[model samples]
Target chain A: MSLTLETNLEDPDAIYEKLIAMLESHEPEKALRASARLVLLLINHIGDRKVIDEAIERAALLTEA
Target chain B: MNVETGKAAWRETIPVWRAFEPSPKPETEFEQARVVIVGTGPVGLAMAIDLGQRGHEVIVLGRFDFVPAGSKAICFSKRSLDILDRLGCGEQAVEKGVSWNIGKVFWKDRSDPVYKFDLLPVKNQKMPGFINIQQYHMEDILLDRLKQLPNVQIRWGHEVTALDTSEESAIMSVDCADGAYRIETEWLIACDGNKSSVRDLMGLDFEGRIFEDNFLIADVKMKEDRPSERWFWFDPPFNPGQSVLLHKQPDDVWRIDFQLGWNIDREACIKPENVNPLVRAMLGDDVEFEEEWYSVYTFQCRRMQHFWHGRVIFAGDSAHLVSPFGARGCNGGFADIDNLGWKLDLVLEGKAPFDILESYDSEAIVTADENILNSTRSTDFLTPKSDISRAFRDAVLDLAEDHPFARALVNSGRLSTAISYPDSSLSTADADVWSGGIAPGSPALDAPLDNGWLLEKLGGRFVLLTTTPFADLPSGLDVLDIAQEPANGLLRERYDLQGGGAYLIRPDQYVAARFRQPTGAAIADALARAMGEQA
Candidate 1:
């Protein structure tokens, strides 16, 4: 087995709308849990640690700013 | 298909009610029995038949004269069917029930299924993965089998009002239609349901979480050609924006459950005017249907602190209650049926000490906890009390439509499977190194045999299932040789046997111990431990 990125979401707009609808009413704790699950799911889908680390660095930079 | 639009006809066709015939009154003030079971529902009746067939004087007390109305618990698992088979009603249940294994999960605003899974991923087994037979039919079949046993006595309308437990026995006051009566028994088995009178009389409190979600189940008789599979919708474009569950049942009837939120008039939701529109939306406008039955229920994952209280033992819904998502309500009760009977019989017969009965308490709690955990998870996914949880659930389903990893996260309902007791107190630790065999304390995995299935031969007695022949054996152990008859190398591969091995199987078809080589002394020791003897 090897690490590879899968362009799985053909319709990202619809999925994004669903994600927004999901987080619409969630509090901070719930949002954090949902974010973790979402990140884990994307990480699992990506299956590449290096790619995940780079994305984490980019996210951390935004948070630091 | 003739779809008559009116009241449910299934109620009309329920064959002439076989009311329990009361036995001749004894001259004694209180009738005595080796075991007195309360409630003649599936759990109580199954236990009565098991103990009765084993030559125990068993008496069952039921409050109602007729079987309860409606399709209460419809999903019968493979393990439950095996237990029913031991009680001699497996074949009938299979013949009359709608069998299914595949289940599909669909999300809101999407037509295609997010994922589908097979419940029974193996072949050459005796029973199907699961069957969708109404609970009433199951009770009728079990009651019919109970009648065949001469030693089993069933008294309808004999409601147990109070219970007094003693050091030696327990006495129960029964309120009959005529007057009041009393009965004394060495052991009392309470299968009385969730609102158990026995538990209330004993002042035992049921403790657990009560979910703030309600589900409305509608059994509708309609004419449609759908695959015999479970179809669940997380947020389909139907009645509510929540979840919906649909299953194909026998007699052209289908069970539909709509997840109603906490704030609603439950009494108003089950009305035909309210429910008919929901069914029409799911089935579309063309399908003609008639309402069979309906009920509203909230989920609760709760159980008693101890299933065994002195001489009186609680089983089934009386001991525990689970969210109906997993079909564990009745199926889990069947697990209790498999665990309690032989231990009770042994203790009553003086063959095994009474402390062995405590194993039933520990084991039932383990099973209840397992069921509660799974049901809670499924309920959380299905209902998602917290907003973040709902979003996570939604994200999983949305991603499941494309990503394979996300599909595994989707939990509609695990659907009942046999809960394995890998840490039972009765099992013997593996003394010898072995591979691929069922571990001690696990339910005996089924493999095809030459003439029949493995489980069909391993029921109703303490069995010494060996591939190699033994010379001197423990007293009262039946020997089943799988050596001569191997079906497609399955038996060898499943048991993970190199040359040959021996398995001490309890009467419930659970593996008590396994050994690499056959020694009579070792086998007897395993048997003694399995019967709850101190080392």
Candidate 2:
């Protein structure tokens, strides 16, 4: 699947799914696998530090899962 | 609909309701709605949105005349984000909310140290760490979505002065400042917050002790250079009588709390003139400031022993009011809505019995107790008055400076995540074995769902999650991009989870179980346990 550059990036579900992929990954080459920075950029745009924390945990878990 | 650039999606014009306007006709004249909710805060409004979207008529009684300001719970759990998703407002709420993870727990005489919530194990995809959104803004988003619900009604300034809950339905009497009208509904939910009049009318005992110390919460806008982190400061580590927590709100705003010893005057904190000095003390003297909110109140860990009496149920501050350390108050109310919503549907449609109401009380009481325990423990660690507790807390800070293992222990508890109710009739199976089944009752691991489906499909009903618990993965479940190697064997059997350790998740996104084959009959046993069907 190709990234659509979704504009609704600040949406919590979007951030959750994006971060989930990042969190569930345990295999090597995550950066090559998916773009975590894009997710961060979206969260950064909203300036909600709390949501950012949740997304970060989800991202890490995505990789681990 | 014209999709214009730079305009809010759906061009949803935000309404500034200066004051509430009531209809001339009596409320009883209107059709009896399916659900009538009191209080229009995040909990009530969110429930209205959920029920309305689910095709039920709802009436939301907003108690106050004005939209209350300042910071409420700024941080949200991943489960909350999922609930927001189910309500069709996830896009707007997430768009407006900011992501944050860096948090600091500091001791007095010691500098602040940052801990990242991002470092914790992620539970689901499509959700971020947590969002820092002012509670008022969250209410605004909810109100907007609520307006879109054709079947929903928001009567601001209408207080529910009296209600009669019987097996047949709920009859309510709403009192405006001037007059009152009656509302008959199939069910009534009290989200009226702490000091809830609805809970009071029911004559239910709110059992809990109030802490001797009072807290001062101040919201300020200042041009200060400090790293963005949710910080807890227990100053003068040895006799740390006072504590402070700093939450960064949007637009150069910070929510700061001073946990002054309970003996201080409450007026000394709420007085607007006294706030400036306190702001300068925290952020340094050089920064100019704009003060938005400042108030003082003592903390209490209290909850109604029974969440429901007859047809009415309680939520949020009404059901339980714990210390703010864990952000449990409003979110707990949300969990109530999630549990009650689907159950209400079942009852109205004759799929379940009226006694199912018992689960709400039993389950929510357990949740309130757990929240109180966690908050009290966190508060003790954050603001230790006793010498022993202070010393123990100091040790963690000392360890944070050098030892990695010690730091890990210090940062172990996920304070903001919503808790699980594995003991409820909603959950099935005994404690067997599974990777995610670390405890007897724990939230199910957010297992993979259907394509394009996130964790939300499980909300509004009970969900059973299971992991096969294998180092090697099955080809079918393994094929999905989100699939995982089983966590372990123990989790599979402990929760009676099939394949990977399965978790029985409640509709509001709480865990019911996390194991494999813990019971012979999956749904029946779990439902029986949740509903108190078994002896």
Candidate 1 per-residue lDDT, tens place, B1-535, comes to 1146422243354332354444334456577777899998899999898898888988888876668767588999998998999889999999999999899988886778898989899777899999999888899899889778988888876778888999889998886655677898888999999989999999897898999898899999998998999999988889556899998888898999999898999889989999889888888888899999877888789999999988899999999999988899999999998899899888878899999988999988888999999999999888887766666777787678778898988899988888777888899999888866899888888888878888988887899888888789987889998777756378778888757788899988889999888799999999999999989
Write the residue-wise lDDT of candidate 1 on A1-65 in tens digits.
Answer: 33334666889899999998886657866666677577767788786778778777777789977
Model 2 per-residue lDDT tens digits across residues A1-65: 22233575558787788766775673443332233333323544555666667666766789987
lDDT of 2 by residue, B1-535 (tens): 2234422232243223343554333545334777888888889898888778777878788766556665566766565776787777766776887656556666566664633345236533566656667888888888888878889878866777777777878887776645677888888888888878887787776787677777788878776767655677656452355677777766677888877775777777678777676667776666788877777766788877788777787888988887777677776777677667766666666656787778777877887888888777766666566755555555555545554444543532336565656565655555554443334345433433444343544545554443333333222121112234333233333333335434545555555444444333554455445533444
Candidate 1 ranges beyond 4 A from true positions? A1-37, A42-65, B1-28, B486-488
- Which candidate's TM-score is highest? 1
Q: Which ten residues in a row have the lowest lDDT in candidate 2 chain B?
A: B473-482
Worst 10 residues of 1 chain B by lDDT: B1-10
| Shift in Å, residue B381, candidate 2 | 2.7
lDDT of 2: 0.64
